[model samples]
Target: MSRVLKPNANNLETGTTTVGMVARDAVVLATDRRVTAGYYIAHRRGRKIWRIDDHVAATMSGGVADVQKILEALTLQAMDYKIRTGLPVPVKTLANYASVAMFSSRPYIFIAHMILGGVTEQEGPVLYTIDWYGSVTEERRFASTGSGSPTAFGVLEDGYRDGMSLEDAIKLGIRAVRAAMMHDPASGEGVDVITITPKEGFKEIDTSKYL
Candidate 1:
């Protein structure tokens, strides 16, 4: 049997900010909550961070509907892979699946960008950026997406360091997203952050206080 996931109609046109970083022991993912529709602000508490599995999560940008569609597809693929193999899907495999999906949909006008981060038994902490056209790049340190990425990259480049503690990585992720929110008109409202570690898997941090 096959399952099909429907996209959210209302979020077809939206703007956002998303960032992901790989630290020594964990991977950090963050994004702004604001959803923009052209010059208007549509939703303030929109969710851009998606949890794919216990150790994998994704941050999204571009059309929310397309983002949701891609996430749904990835989630289904992960579940099927686990059921068939009795093992969790690796971070790279998931990235490759997403890349194929994006590339197949490119000619149809489906557009979305994603930053996927996770911890695996073999790869430890890893991060990958999947562009709208299905091009995937494994980012050794960090990656950012959406309209505010330029501003977010500034903070990430300045603050990120090798082998930093997970706490410090979370703080840096927050700082990067916060800087983008402050400067990017399309990115604002609040920040959502998640950390993936071998011990605790994927967990979301309460970042309301940071805004």
Candidate 2:
């Protein structure tokens, strides 16, 4: 991660952290948006976090190109599967499929960690972290992943609480990223924050509002 921070200005460097806070019957997904190029800041508003469908969203970190490809493939697959089956893919089923696809990629392995968040058809909101090998597991109230994750997780552990409101959740997410930027060499200055709730699929919120 530190290596990415010290590269040449023309070389693209990126790092991210996804936080999922679970409440009684809902979940709030958030991420710190930071993408750099070597020592230079390239994009402050790069939305590394996104919704894959009406009820499923993900926040990803790692090799940018690999992550993008995996996301595109997964999106297409999900759409096709849904169209054919006439039902949204179950969260567990989608996670399992992603795991298989990512684990099988050869050339450049997808060194990415993504937080898959959404409300299940039968259950309430669910949150899980998926890794490069496609390993996925449920999280508690909150979880963070990526190069800056160690630091971000610290902040989250301190601020996270059950039944947190959307505004509070956003604040905690920003605070966690801010804390990470202070200590993580790979995580830079600018923070891009996004939110995904049951009503709203995915929405990028103003950093100033959270900061």
Candidate 3:
């Protein structure tokens, strides 16, 4: 990571959702957008989730600027990794490498947390959250983080089901973020939702429908 993750810095607060589903042959991931700056709305269409490669996408919640930086850095590194290895790294492996890079660059900084989701060329689909210190681990169904994670998780627990459809995923994502917006001062108002279907690739959903 080129930039440091500073835990104490209070620049921006955010909420994000990263969902991973394993179908018969593909994977899907989705994320939400909502950022709060102090007592005001910062960005309504913050694209917290992104496609860094054809088969990989990520959702982030942390220092907005820092997370953006990490995304750029990761994109470059991912391209390099693909070029050098001629293979697609598993989502877990890529995320673990990112964690190591972040901590090694600045151990004192705790500025970013992220969920990476993708399907390996051989291992099916995967989802994992990388913490401020760069610890990465797998999540079975879905994962969320940031200021509104707790509230959002409440909705996730109630609605998530195995092998849920793309429609269900979107519904649950909106409901979770909507509920979070109600209580989490740092979340809500405007929403940016994105869904990635393995073969079709990433699509930034119409914000009007989600909000």
Candidate 2 structure quality by residue, lDDT tens digits, 103-169: 7875435666677777665656778877766678888678887666788888888888777777787
TM-score per prediction, in order, is: 0.91, 0.81, 0.81
Report the lDDT tens digits of candidate 3 across residue range 1-211: 1122234445434444434444334444444555555555666766667677777787777767767777787788778878999976566667877888778866365577887877665766677787766678788888877777778789888988887777777767778777777777666545555565556655666656655
The TM-score, computed over Cα atoms with residue i paired to residue i, of candidate 2 is 0.81
Per-residue error for 197 in candidate 2, Å, reads 2.8
The lDDT of each candidate is 0.84, 0.68, 0.66
lDDT ranking, high to low: 1, 2, 3
Worst 10 residues of 1 by lDDT: 1-10
Candidate topping lDDT:
1
lDDT of 2: 0.68
Q: Every model's Cα RMSD, please?
A: 5.6, 4.6, 4.0
**Candidate 1 local lDDT, 1-211, one digit each (tens):** 0011333434332357788998988999988888877767888888889999998999978776778899999999889999999887999999999899888874564567789999989989999998767889999999998778889999999999999998898899999988988888889888889999999999989876654
lDDT of 1: 0.84
